[model samples]
Target chain A: MEAFVTLDAVAVPLPLPNIDTDQIIPARYLSRPREVNHADFLFHDARRVPATDEQNPEFPLNREAWREAKIIVAGKNFACGSSREAAVWALFDAGFRCAIAPSFGDIFRNNGTKNGLLPVVLPAEVVEDILAQLEASPGAHIHVDLPKQEVTAPDGSTHGFEIDPFAKHCMLNGLDDFGVTAAYEDDIAAFERRYGRENRI
Target chain B: MSEPSGPRTLFEKIWSRHRVTEREDGQTLLYVGRHLLHDGGATAFDVLRQRGLKPRAPDRIFATPDHYVSTAGRKLAEIEDPRHREMVEKLARNTAEHGIRMFGLGDPNQGIVHVMGPETGLSQPGLLIVCGDSHTSTHGAVGALAFGIGSTEVAHVLATQTLWQRKPKTMRITVDGTLGPQVTGKDVILAIIARIGAAGATGHVIEYAGSAIRGLSMEGRLTLCNMSIEAGGRAGMVAPDETTYAYLHGRPYAPQGAEWDQAVMHWRELPSDAGAVFDTEVSLDGSAIQPMVTWGNSPEDALPIDAAVPDPESAADAERRAQMRRMLDYMGLVPGTPLTDIAIDRVFIGSCTNSRIEDLRAAAAVADGRKVAEGVLAWVVPGSEPVKRQAEAEGLHEVFRRAGFEWREPGCSMCLGTNGDIARPGQRVASTSNRNFMGRQGPGARTHLLSPAMAAAAAVTGRFADVRRLVGG
Candidate 1:
């Protein structure tokens, strides 16, 4: 995991709400290993016109100005379905380091923390304003400072957002849960032995 | 988090018992009792292999290949896509290498992970269960603290038999009155989502209570809990009682003899104590719930069977109006049209939600003497091999076959359509699965979620109809 302390980059505006994991990366590409670059599969279905192989010109990512965006300013409840971490992988592989939304699916939000893609939750009106600003200036940059837990809008307004302290610490240090949890192996093993012996479960 | 000295809710009791340690950052390390795996876990296993880490406790894990397995046959070669076949094969290889128990293809226990966990008694009361699939919440029907995790968390649990987490707040959704005819758990859950939007339960663990909830069968409870994620709930559970005990009594993985007596005693104390408070409380009149059908992209877009498609012009705000317009366009539904009048091209009566023997019996009863309406393609895929065998023994398959619904092998067929069981683009489907998201079935496919009986009703009528009218009291 790459530590995410701060970033300033081009942001894309996706104003649609409830953009689920199935849209982020379809189940068809789920069989591929993590080593496979998932950039091509990001929004695999939604980036195209429904029932056609052609790329939909109206999609934000397809527009020339936002083609190299490293941030996403989206609507409420973005990535609201499924527990697929592959969705986060696709976004990260496509070079998106952060997402700002009114809300997010719990599993998708948690997956973002583990995979180094920061999911920032802001007030709905604030997010709406950000989306508007990004849409106004298509190739504009937004500043995200993790150490301060603040997001500077394209118009230069700074807003604070809350995140789980542990998740924030891990994100800042580039620490994955596996290694940190593995460090407590002895304690876990002792508990398992006692738990199994006493409960017989 | 400090240990409370007073009465605790069911969720708090389970959470405290599973707690191994707490970090200064407030993330508690929880000891996982059972970890369920499906074919989607192939990548998680790959991560473990890359790290050269072995499963700390392989005995705590159970694997089954469902997401990518072909529902048309039992053989691995039957999976049309080589990539999909490799996923299922890798599950077998990974489980074998780790010494984890896998109900591989052709095994009697093989089926959707959610369905298999409860049927085999692997999901038990007071246990903290986790699975890579969102529907794992279905096991919480047995009073377990079961929830879903992502691929990275899957690898973490595989390497260490625990997960670090901040505890979710507790909610009690009490449905008090007796349910009306054809008002099954599917209807109850849909009604809940309609009343409380899709994100209503975000960051909360829901405990279902009240007389109406207690009255439901185990299968109905499973159906309700299976869609917890659809409502944005971390997990949903019903307290264990005689119904739960009866269901687990003689199952393969359940405790036996003296241990069974001991386990039951402990389970009896697992329910929330009197005067124990929840962070949030929601109550509903179960009798008011009618059979529901989703008319748009989200599960919250559901309406009663007799309702009309919502007009976007009636929306409260501009944003709401635009969202409704887009959903209506995608679903190809006209405002003012009765839900019963909407025609469907396909009918699916299976998934982790509503694919147990009880669900098949309900569908079969609806299909008993009625022929499937022409131009409708209906399929009845059982949840697991045991469910299939049970349905066959009861002759439910013949009833479905006679009614023109295809009787297929067990897997998650047509649910997410990962196994080539998708409907054609632009086709409308009456389905019994949990989600009704955009392109959930297939690109450009519209899904109307309903109960198994309701799905059968649509299949026989060629359009959405009230199952209450078809299945007379």
Candidate 2:
């Protein structure tokens, strides 16, 4: 499950920090059962105003160029609250292949990686440069070389991406949560067989 | 004598012992020994009523409301917000409707769900517990296999008292050194996260060990256990030691006399042997940590008291660079700005993260004989009403009031924005609570996550400053 990993497609500048899980997928969405089409929720809170009919001023996704963004370039400490894995599920389910940030809260990082969402941390200057580049050329795609660990922008430029060796291992295998647990299947079974019923669990 | 190859790390002993049925795919259908309930949990009970399913074992389930209860509006009858009042009303009605033990609002036994659970003995050693709250892992310090479940899974536990879980791998983090003055369990966990980066412990159950952990009080251990989620781990724990036993003695739920002695004997045997090995081992020096603060959105994006905000240029990863710029813009923080010079408009001193009595005492020491800065909007919200009353009776509230801080009642309060308590847009707040991501306090507000003492100092200074400096330096 371990290998060199890199992805560079489009630089989607979210340009916001402290984007919480509630904003990513509002709590009311949780009241509803899981569904395949949760992408509308990406900016439900942002798009609440009435003038949003034509302008859609209320949704974060309403930003024209960012509507189909698969790569998110965001501010420091993204996803700092809540332990909801659904936040990541919604992002991945929405079409985010990779998310570049200065930092992510502990639970968000784990949840993002657990679901195969790549979170790349770089120096703030380098991230800004990418944001500037995206502004210069909207809909630009970059080439991410996982083996080389670099992201090559639309202008034929490149930048390095750092990921923990372990997380990289999980993403490359496409294992996510189920994959990690399967590794110790034999021991888990043996333990349960010996102590299962009498435990009155 | 047994070979010392694998003496069974506490994580292994607990994880291996809890499995009931394992599918070939590796997920386990494990029976839950206990389920600690919180306000967020009443929704599950409501679902059960709608479905007409009775909980399989009422004795194993426990309920308390910490998230939605109003700290200021204690009397349920006085709550003006219909939604907030209805939530509390639902909590009371739901607990009784389900036959679950109810720690209704204003009950002496009522407090933060995690705080009251262990204090009351329902969260004992060797048991597996689950709650809808992430901090449910706090019970692991007592040697229990506890973790948080989602709402749907919360419903499953409510009905069948079981969870389908995939076992986590093991991570052993040992900090073997003396903690410096003013450093705390909070500092230790923050330091670990900063040192390893946020994803260092993902997909693993971390067992905290060595001198630093052993030296912690039971409450300190719980504080450390509480931040396991912040460390990207499924859970964190320390084996029950003498401190654990001492804290558990004479509590309403703990075993007494002969039963207590027997329980102690079993608890004493909880530690791993000298030669025990783990799948992974990480070590740290405790002395290196200082009173820490999260400078960026992530818990790992932290630095010591006197440091410059991270320059985006120093970010080595492409994704990192992009995110750094966004965070700085939202926070209105300029790169190269000295963290010490960053002024705060508000200082909030409460949350499940740092609202306990010990936390209050620590903050009070900073507020004693001092007053908040002219423009700082400060608050002292205790974790529970009992804590608030206890502080008031002890004059801790006076210390806070003397410091020009608003000494408020119990409830989640401003830690979350749901209670109509939030900072206005563009307000910079030094918070003693956890999760300082942009706008976490309210729309357009910037938060700097700090220790409680640090929050007090910030209140007095109206800027990020060291609490130790106020005393002498």
State the weakest 10-residue window (summed lDDT) of model 1 chain B: B315-324
Worst 10 residues of 2 chain A by lDDT: A27-36
Query: Per-residue alpha-carbon lDDT of model 1 for B238-299, expressed as tens digits?
Result: 99999999999999999999999999999999999999999889999998888999998889
Candidate 2 local distance difference test against the native: 0.72
Q: Write the per-residue lDDT of candidate 2 for residues A135-170, one digit (tens) a residue.
A: 787767766665566777666777787765556665
Deviation of model 2 at A190, angstroms: 17
Model 1 misplaced regions, further than 4 Å: none
Report how far off residue A163 is in candidate 2 (Å). 20
Q: Provide chain B TM-scores across all predictions.
A: 0.99, 0.95
Q: Give the TM-score of candidate 1.
A: 0.99
Clashing pairs in 1: none
Runs of candidate 2 with Cα error greater than 4 angstroms are: A1-23, A26-41, A44-60, A63-81, A85-201, B1-5, B46-51
The per-model DockQ list reads: 0.74, 0.11
